[model samples]
Target: MRKIILSASVSLDGCFEGADGGLDWHLVDDELHTHFNDQLRGMSAFLMGRVNYELMARVWPDADADPSSSGPEAEFAGIWRETPKIVFSRTLDRAGPDATVMREVDPEAILELKRRPGGDMSIGGARLAARFRQHDLIDEYRVYVHPVILGRGRPLFEPSDDRKPLALAGTHTFGNGVVLLHYKSD
Candidate 1:
């Protein structure tokens, strides 16, 4: 069965976004962006929250059309457009092509998807990842930790009553001040 990987760019302080709901601090330069493209290109599908899906749909769909788009940016645009996406939303009535809007996260349904013949799936959005964590569905975690401290912002992992241990799978540092820490559930 394909694995469910929860991928996110977080801060050194363990925050995903700032108080104003911005990720300007993320140091996603060419090296990191290319790494993202390489990592996501092989995924069978993306599982994301409505907010994250909408945010990506707004920019990535036509990002390559812009003359100013960099090589990595254009590459990611195509990858994002071609990849199948499953959006979890209660408010969204529909989604774009190659996308499905789910009313909620169904663990059995996700497991069924994993059982099918395909590459691993990537899960986005902190809240949605938390839900997957609650169900113990995530098989791996690919965290890109940037060199910044958002002292105040939404944390990557919300406070939980239970503790889940992870074993380090691998680590890589990019030219930019970002590090990819791959971990697997223990």
Candidate 2:
């Protein structure tokens, strides 16, 4: 079975976004970008929330068309734009070709997708990840823990009744003081 991997760049204080949903705090350095790009190589499908989809839709597909673009962001955006995405939202009427609105129900759709033939399905966005966590549907957690501490923001994990134990699979420190942590559900 394919794995439901939840991955994100989060602050030391466990905030995924700053007040006003500012994500300027999470910067992808060369080493970190390379590391994340390598991880993306194995992902066959991408899943995210509507908010994240809207945010990502602005830059990813258009990055290649921009003449002023340069460096890893362009490359990452190209790859991200090409990847198949499933965005979960009740209010979203339609999504572009790069992504489609999820038609099935939440956890069931995730499970069905996991069982299908694929490399690995990646779950992005904090809200979507929280939903997976709430349903105990996530198989792995690939987290990039940045050194900065934001005292307030949207949390990585929302209030839920379900809580499962995780075993650390690996840890690596990058040059930019970011720690890459891989954990598997126990």
Q: TM-score, each model?
A: 0.98, 0.92
lDDT of 1 by residue, 68-180 (tens): 99999999999999999999999999999889999987889988998999999999999999999999999999999999889999998999997899999999988887888
Most accurate candidate by TM-score: 1
Local distance difference test, each candidate: 0.93, 0.83
User: Quick one: RMSD of model 1?
Assistant: 0.8
Name the TM-score of candidate 1.
0.98
Clashing pairs in model 2, backbone N/Cα/C closer than 3 A: none
Query: By lDDT, who's the top model here?
Result: 1
Q: Poorest 10 consecutive residues of model 1 by lDDT? A: 26-35
Which ranges in model 2 have alpha carbons more than 4 Å from their true place?
A: 103-105
lDDT (tens digit, per residue) of candidate 2 on 69-140: 666667778778778988889888888887789753467777888889978888888867876787788899
